[model samples]
Target: METTNEFERYQKAKKQVEDIKGFYGHLASYVLVMGLLIFINLRYTPQYLWFVWSMLGWGIGLFFHAMKVFNWFPFFNKEWEEKKIKQYMEEEKKTNKFE
Candidate 1:
């Protein structure tokens, strides 16, 4: 049981590290792509300045991704939601009722 618990902890840590790494990778890509887009927009069509659209669109997605990856979202999260569900299920079982 102890070993199993340790393995679970290790797995969770590994998953979290992967998520952080993935977010950094996304950030890097966003930087590179947006830089290119800005350069193009400035060079070819400075009057139109269309890169802002892409910037805002992808930025909103990046913000949400950061929120989820870093747990900045205060409302809830998958792990907390699952734990709550399990807790409520156990409580329902104890009461011999569910709603």
Candidate 2:
């Protein structure tokens, strides 16, 4: 039993680490690509700054990605789902008892 719990914890930790790593990788790619875009836009068309649009769009996506990885919205996660399911089950049990 102890070993099983330890294994589960290990898996959870591993998954969390992977999530963090994935976020960092995404950030790195964004930085590199945006840097290139900045150079291209400034060098070729100094009057038209179009990189801002791409940055805004991709930044929004990245922000959402970070939120999911960091669990900023806890209500949408696995633990919350499990808790809600159990709560409903308990309510059903109480109703059945009365019946």
Candidate 3:
């Protein structure tokens, strides 16, 4: 019984991690597509050195997307999601206790 409970916890944690990653990926995709459009516009216009800004924006947004997808960036490691979910659960427990 104890082992089953532990397994369930692990599964739940893993699922939460995937869910967070999926959510981040979806949002990042939207940002990336917009950045791509900005890049294209800058390339075409080349009026006021906007290309640099577009590239920077695209790079930063893509970098985060890569980090979330790969779970290898220094600040956003795989463990981050686990910690976040655990923290959320802890907060929920406290909130529930008060209510």
Candidate 4:
């Protein structure tokens, strides 16, 4: 049982680390690709800044990806969910005084 628990913990940690690494990899790729795209756009069309569209669109996605990986939204994270669940359960228990 102990070994199983240890193995599960190890797997969870590994998965979390991999997720963080993946997010960083995505961020690096975004920077490199967007940089190249901006360079190309400027070189070909100096007056039109169309690269901003792709950058903005992908930037929003990247922002959400970052939020998910980092758990930036406090109210929506696992801990918050657990707390809310417990709070609601306690409230329900209180309301069921007859039981």
Candidate with the greatest lDDT versus the true structure: 2
Model 4, 1-99: lDDT tens digits are 999999999998898899899999999999999999999999999899999999999999999989988888868887899999999999999989968
Q: Which 10 consecutive residues of model 1 have the lowest summed lDDT?
A: 90-99
In order of lDDT, best first, we have 2, 1, 4, 3
Off by over 4 Å in 2: 91-99
What lDDT score is found at residue 81 in candidate 1? 94
lDDT (10s digit) by residue, model 2, range 1-99? 999999999999999999999999999999999999999999999899999999999999999999989999858888999999999999999999988
In the range 1-99, model 1's lDDT, one tens digit per residue, is 999999999998899899999999999999999999999999999999999999999999999999989999765897789989999999889888643
* CA-lDDT, candidates in order: 0.94, 0.95, 0.74, 0.94
Q: What is the C-alpha RMSD of each candidate to the true structure, in Å?
A: 2.6, 1.8, 7.8, 2.2
Model 1, CA-based lDDT:
0.94
Considering only N, C-alpha and C atoms within 3 Å, which residue pairs clash in candidate 2?
none
Better of 2 and 4 by lDDT: 2
lDDT of 3 at 50: 65
Most TM-score-accurate candidate: 2
Candidate 1 vs 3: which has more TM-score: 1
